[model samples]
Structure formats: structure tokens, C-alpha cells
Target: MTTRINAVPRAVPAEEVEVPFADCYITTAAQHAALRVLRSGWLTTGREVAAFEAEFAGYVGAGHAVAVSSCTQGIELALRSFGLPRGSLVLTSTMTFCGAVQAIVHAGLQPVLVDVDAGTGMPTPATVRDAVRAYGPPAAMTVVHWAGDLADVPALAEAAGLTLDQIVVDAAHALGTSAGTTPIGSQCAATCFSFYATKNLPLGEGGMVTTNDPERSRWLHQARLHGMTADAWRRYLPGGSWRYDVAEAGLKANMTDLQAAMGRAQLTHLPAWQHRRAQIAARYDTLLAAQPGIALPHRPALGTGTHAWHLYPVRLAPGIDRDEVIAELAQRRVGTSVHFIPVHQLTYFARIASVPPAGMAGADTLFGQLLSLPIHPRLTDGQIDAVCAALADATHRQFTRKGAS
Candidate 1:
């Protein structure tokens, strides 16, 4: 028998518990690391950044890692490293952060927005194949590890008949996620991770690109800092040369020592943080199991992989106004968010798109009902219960309203 939290509707009280949709977890070690960087004379990309790259590479089992200012820059640099022709189509999911699509565009590549699996909100092998059939074969693809769930890149590539080198992964939410025994960063040509404030590894602003190809890694290292052969750290440091060559035009996207120091410190606490996130997700599963008019997050089968639990999104039943439910939850002092509003539906992308998107029904359907609840290391058991209770009451009100209408 499964345990369930009772969902009884009640009037809103003056002191309802407050639950934020997301929060950053910063350890004391991270704070100390930041202070140490401040005290050091060298603040730009230097020893700290190098150490963070090596540690991150080792953690993800990647051959090489290059630190960047943001995941968006990492993806752009990764795509540019491919040297694909201008206007080359890069297949990517519509249900992702705009940064992924923006990266492709910044690389001078056209983004072919592919539909995702309605159930998982991730593009599967079949979806990739469908996109290929509709848009012709793309030069490459950017696979997003949605909501901390790792997509099967090898299988998707094999099904689409593309080489591993043709795949770039947006692992913004999947720092600790793995597919079977393989970690996320090691599966593709280049995998990018975000250390954004609200991410699993909160470093305010930092990203890393992991690749097994040495040549690509070397290219990214230069590409991140204006294509210079050497950076200021090398030029101004002792026994350093000011003479350098600009091999190619690149963006200013290097990660600073301060961010890297914090990243290194936060990496140490990732395991414990991930464990707590899992526990919160399990507690949500138990509490919300019996609630009506809502669907829980999809859990991958046992042994397939581990989720990072960055976001816990539930889908509301059909005909319930998702916005109204969100408002209701806010009234009850519970915060929530929608994962995304399909990229194709965005005003800018839609107006710029040359052709209409095909096979977007899945993405369209999923976007309407998606609602992300609070799920982070800081969430306590009582908070989880409060979130559930608020959600239950809010949805019940929506259902009742719909029935009456």
C-alpha cells in the first residue's frame, strides 16, 4: 500500500506557509572560496579556473573541460568548433531554454525546433528521426537533458545516423545525472553545464564544456577568449610573453577566478545536495500519489539512470486553467513556475522562422499543463507537505470551477 497525504480543501488563513519555486544552496566552503579569490591578486581566469576545469573534468569522466562565462556561451563555442557551413540546420527541442536556440543562431546555424515526447518533455530517437524526415538531415543536433533527466544520446544518434561528434549536449540541469554507468558529460562531442544561481551547482554565473576530443577542447579554450593564443593571466604573470596571435574571432566568454573558486567549493557538496533532492522528490511522490486532477513527474525505470531533480513539474488535468491554478497557489502562499513555453510559440522565433514547424503537437500539449513545483536541497519535509497541500487545494478549486462552468 502506498502512503498518501490527505487533500482537504480549506479557507486561506493569514499565516499560510510560504514555499518558493526555487532557491540557491550556497555552502560555507563556497563563501570562503569566494573570499580567498578576493584576497588573491589574480582575479581573472587563472589557477583557480584551471583547477576547477580539471576537477570538473574528473568528476564527469571527460577527457577535457573548458570553463566559460555561461552555458549559452559554452554551447555557442562548441557549435562554432564544429566549423559547419553557415545556415546549417541544428536540430534541438522546442521545449528548452531559449539560450540553446540562441546559441545555435549565434553560431550562424539555423535551429530546427524538434518536438519532444509529451510524457517526458524530451526528444527521443523517434522525434529526432521525425525532424530529420521533415527538415532533411541536419549537420548536427543539440540535445537538451531536460529537467535533470538525461536523454539517451547514443541511441538517438544511432537512430538518426549521426556520429557522436555531431552531437552537442545542453546539460544545464544534469550535473550529476548519468545514463546507466556513463555520465552525461562523456556521452557527446561537447557537453555544457550551467552553474547558474538556481541550478544544482550555484555559482552565480559560470559554465563548463566537457569534451573527449583534444583538438576541440583546445579550440574552445581559445574561442572562449577572443581567439587569442594566450590570455592576460599568461601575459602579465612572471615569465610570460606579451606577444600572441589572434587565430580567429571569438567572443569574450571566459570564466573568472572568483566564479571558478566558488564552483570548486560547491562541487564538494554536490553529492549530499543531490541526495537531499532525491529524498524530497520521493516525499513528493508519496504525498501527491493519490491526488486527483494532476499527474506527477515521470520517473525513469530503475537502473536506467539517476535524475538530478532540478525541477519537479506536474501536469494538470485537461480543461483546468493552469494560470488560474498558479494564481490560486500563490494566494495560498505556494510559488510555482512553468518549465517553458515552446520556442516556436515565442514571438521572436515565430516571426523569424522561415518555415512552419511540423509534428509540434506533443510540445504544444505539454506546454499548456506544465507546472514546476519547488524542489531543491533546502526544502524540508514540512515544506514539501505544505507544497502538496497547497497544490491539492488549488487544483481542487480549479476542478470545481471547471465542473460548474
Candidate 2:
């Protein structure tokens, strides 16, 4: 059940109905914002980054938000601040982006990869309880709100013998999501967001860290830019001193003005974009539900949280060849993707977390069957039908080929 992509290349007609898996949402305002930065003298982490940080923090209801180069760096920067000794254990899911596992390693902590909910792709309370039972309590934990579904961090914390104070949320997907009316940013010790081109609120590349902890917040601001007491923007401003000092060896992970300009523009439009995505997801749920053997993604519980719907992943029934189906969908001019290849399956992690055997029972079983359909805000209604029709046709063909129907 390894999640290897199919290698053979195939072509689809340029004039045929084609549905892209992901498309970046950009507006004239975003372009104008970026151009405004280009026109400004300060191109680095200057006023725009500061503005985006403040605006994002206000939106997420966090005390502070630090803009970083990327979410991977944000997580690494945050974990390093904790001063956990090298090899100190940290619990996380195998069913996530490798950056999470790599960040734990980069932060000088040993990652104990555990199983996730096979169907929903979430690391549940059970996953935490088992990891705690098998490896003992970790110094910290990182939880991903799988596909923008809010994780019950309170239950997860209780199971892992930690508190909400020790959990960092890999909320790369849950920017607009909420848990029981509380936005995700206010629900964890630290929350990291990505502005990768495909995210709900994307720039080409950027990230942010939001937290309620003031001391950690201040440390993060200083730590993002060479641990300098004052950034170039501040130091070069009027009434600013030329003299400054570095307090700690830190990262060059500061967000640039240009990136922030784009982020701010996107942030302004995020609510509208979120609504569009929700509409698309609701349509997909209705359309894809009719396709036999395709299991739709789980929505966030009605009162528990609002789903960000970052991805619209579906699982094929047992015995279907997912790779073949993807190729089949491609032939029908529909693009498709898998959310992740369980971290432990990667050769580098296999060597590092080799002990405990990656007992990723659930992720191991779920790997081959998952596929993400296009659900971006820009997708047109016609394209939606194309994608679903292609999926249904592809599924019927794949099952027929396998003689499973």
C-alpha cells in the first residue's frame, strides 16, 4: 500500500474538458499590492510584513503573529525556542507532510511516528494514547488539523500527558477553521500557517506563527531575523540608531515586504475565498457521493468546528488500484493527487525512526487508496462536473479492470 505515483506519461486534449487539481487564487489587488512593494524602498521584512503580522493576528484572535519564510521554518523556529534537548521525544503523525517529521528532527527532538485515523487521516486521541503507552510521554506534540478539520487538542493533550501549553498546531490548512466557535489560532500553544501557492490564503511562498504566549511571541520576532535587537527597517528608520546587537544565533526566516503585500491582499479576500471553497466542497460532496466505491472526506463536526476544506480527498474502495485510477482520470483530462506519503515510508525517516518499526498500521493501510480532487476557489461549475464525471468514469473502468465490481 505504498503511495508511489504512476510513472507513465499520457496526454490529454487541449480542447477537451480539463479540471486542474489546484490553482492559485490571485486578484488585481494582490498584484497591485506586490507592485506597491516593488515601488517601495524597503523590500525586506519591513512595514508590510509588520502589517500582515498584525492583520493576521487580529483575524486569528492571537496576541501576536510572526511572519516567517515558510511553515517548516516556523515550526523549527518555534520548537527551538522550547530548548528541548536533542533526542527528546516528540509525538506526531506519520500521515502528514514530511516537513513536520523533519522539523521535529531539526528541533533536536526524536519523533515517534504513530498511526492516524485510516478514513479521516487524523491523529486521534487513540493515536496519542498508544504512542504515549509505547514510547512514554513526549516533551512536546505537534498536531495537524487533517484537511482543515479541527483536532480535539484537549483530548489529544490529555492522552499524551501534556497540556494545551505544549502542543503546536501544524495548521497549514486550518486558517479559517474553528473549534467550538474558537478559531484555531487561539486553541493551541503555537500555530503555524503556510502561504504556499496552493493554500486558501496563498502567496507564492510565506508562513506565519501565531501564539498567545507573549514571551515566546517576542522571542520569535527577534529570532526570525538573525536574533537582532532591531530589524533593518527599524534601525534605518528616522530617529533609529545605527548600533544594534544580536542576542542569539537565529534564523534568516523573516518574511519579506513583497510576500507580505501579497499575503495582506489575500487575507483581505480570505473570507470570500473561504465561502467559495465551502460551496465547491458542498457540491463535490453531493456529486462525488454518487460515484460507487469512492469515500468522501469527513466534514468537521457541525457544532464542533467549521472545516476549512483545504483538500477534498477521497478514498477508493479496497482492491482498487489508485495509481491506475489516477492515470485513468488523467486520460480523461482530470488532474488528481495524493495528500501525502506517510513520513516513515520515506528512506531518510525510515533510517531515523527505524526503531519502534513505524507501526503505522492505519497510515500503512490507508496509503494506496487516497486521492485529492480539485477544490480550489477558482474552480468553475463546469470544471466541477468534468472532475466528478471523470472520477466516476475512471472508477468504473478501474473496478472493471480489476474484476471487482
Candidate 3:
């Protein structure tokens, strides 16, 4: 099955009930920041880039942050930074986006897929332990914070017999999330964040890797920009030297000043945006909970962690075709999305890893029933109501009256 990044479009694009599945919450601050970057004349990596890096690192409580082109690049950089030998085992979640798995393969490591917890859509200590037991110790592992709910990394690491340094967190959905006292980026070897247009901190396109190791930070800083000793920020200064040396060969995944400016503005307003997202998700929980044959997102127990609510996913009961319902909802002009098709089920990975859907019990079960409702900061109360009403109607038409018009 093909994956659609945004929700499938409505048949006629309903005027009465048009709600997008995701919308970037941009404000005047972001506009002005972009304008400033445009007028600055020095558009590539510059002062704005440095400031955004510092501010994002502070927000996530990480020691250092290196801005990159996208979450995809950040993951690849994190894996490549480890310098693991070729064909080394790298276990990761089967429920996550393809980027994590792609990064492992691109880094010349063999990916061993692990099933996720059906409740949280995260690989558990048991799952990791089982994979490690089957595959033997891996050189490293990547844990994805699915739908902004963080996995208990320490527990997972211990269960898998690996140290913190051997783990990289795919935190694309978990910018502000935490587990107990530890935030997402601060605990892992390196945590990668996305600033995609629809992300919590939307900047059109960008990413950041946060880590405690200064050496790794320095390496990533250079590694993102073709291993140049000093970025244009330093090289373009009046006293800056044009002569620079390549410390190591690296990928061209550096974030531009323009993107950094918008990101900085988004970062400033993130707390408010997050609060709004939570409110929207709460409305979803209340709206969808009373109905039978549907499962809401499994929220983390209070004080255990915070949910970023990047996507509000629900699983339909058995016998309901998830795609049919999604199409029905789109007919009502209410947008919906699927968080993922198990990476193992996608044609490319299925061909490479060659794991049948039945092999990953949790992932297979979740994939069949998954659908993400319209959830974002820009959704109005009436829009939320329309979404819920459309869902209720879709269920009624699809299941309660199966053969009826």
C-alpha cells in the first residue's frame, strides 16, 4: 500500500466541513523573522542558525544542538557518527517512519526489526530484549518516539543489554516530551528532531540533532556542511579566514539561515502551540471515547511522560476496513491520515527485510486499524466538532448499516 503524507483529499472539497489533517501554526513572529533573513543578504548558515541551535538546545535541555536539513538527514548523521562497522546489527522499531530504517541501511548496518507495544506504538523493553536475544548484541539501536509518546529508554536499554551511548532516539514527533524527569533529547546518545512544515515546530524544512557529547556536537556541526572547519557564520566574518580544511567527508544537509529564523520564532511559541494541541487531543478523546469498537490513543500515565499530540490516532474494531472509513470521512470533507504502514509492510523494506505482516504481531495488528484524525493547532472548535461528527457518521454508514445507502 502507498503512504500518503497528508490526508486523502475530499471528493468535492466540502465548503461546509473542510478541515485539514495537519496545518503549520505560523505567526507574525515567523513572518518577520523570515523577512529579516531575506534582507540580511547572508542567507546560508549565519547568526540566525547559531541562535536557533542554542535556543533549541536550551528548550530540549540538551548540551548541544546541530541544525541539519531534515529529520532524515539527522538520523543518518546520528548513525554515521557512531562509525559502526558494516553489517553490524542495528535493531529499531517496526512501527516507525521509514527514515529511521533507511538511515540504518545507508550507514551500512543491518536492521533487525522489533515489534512495538500495541498500546503505545513503541518498542518495549520486552520487545527489544527479545530482538537482541534472537539477533545477538547489536552495535547500536534507534528508538522512535511514536506519536510524541516517549519510550522508556533506560528500561529498554537495560533490557536489551546496551548502554545509553549505543542508542539514538528518533524524536521527530517528540520535541517537548519527557519520561519522568528526563526529556527526550537529554538522555540518549543523540536525539533527532524534525522541523517539517507540519511538525510541532514548523519551519517549512529543517532538523536538529541534540546530544551531550561536545565532540559529537562539533563533529555534527562540521559534518552537516561537507566537513568544513567553520560554517559560513565564522568564515564570512571580517576577520574570518577563507582557507578551511575538511575534517572528514560529510553530507550536505545544513540548515539555512532562513529556515533557522522561522524555527526560532516557532520555538518561542511552542509552549502555547503545544497547549493548544493538547486541548484538541483532549476534545478528540472525549468525542471518540463513548463509541464502541474504537480505541483511542494510549496516553502515558500522569507524571510518567508528556504527549506532544502530534497526531491523534485511533484503531477501529475488528471487521471495519480502515481505508474505507478514511475514504468515507474524506467524503464528509473531514481529513484523516494514517500514522504509518508498518515499515516491514512497505514494498521496499518488505523486499529487503522480507518480513511478512504476520511476523510483527503488534505492528500488523495496529496497521490494519490505524487512522489519524484531523489534529493540529489551527483547528477551531467547530472544526473539531465537524471532524467528530463526520467520524461518527462514517462509522454508522460503514459498520452499523453495512449494506444500506
The TM-score of candidate 2 is 0.94
Find the 10 residues in a row with the least total lDDT in model 2: 1-10
Worst 10 residues of 1 by lDDT: 1-10
RMSD of each: 4.4, 5.8, 5.1
State the C-alpha lDDT per candidate: 0.86, 0.84, 0.83
lDDT string, candidate 2, 1-405, tens digits? 111222232443333777888887677888898899898877998989989999999999999999999999999888888877789888888889999788888877898887888977888888777788788778988889888977778888888899888888999988888988778897778999999988888887889999998999999999998889888998899999988899777888999999999888878888877888888888888898878899989877678889998998889998778888888888877888898999888999988862344377788778878898887877776777778877787788877877853
Query: Which is the leading candidate under TM-score?
Result: 1
Which of 1 and 2 is the better model by TM-score? 1
Give the Å error, residue 320, model 1.
Answer: 1.3
Candidate 3 structure quality by residue, lDDT tens digits, 1-405: 111122233344234878888886667888888999899898998888899999999998999999999998998899889988888888888898898799888878888888887778888887787787777888888888899986788888887788999999999999878887666798888999999988888877899999999999988998999888987779779998988999677989999999999888878778777888898889888888997768999777888989888888898988887788888888777788888888988888877752423368888888888888887777776777778877777777666676563
Give the TM-scores of the predictions, in the order they appear.
Answer: 0.94, 0.94, 0.93
Candidate 1: the clashing residue pairs are none
- Per-residue CA lDDT of model 1 for 99-172, tens digit only, reads 88899998999988888889899887877888888778889988888999868788777766788889999999
Say what the RMSD of model 2 is.
5.8
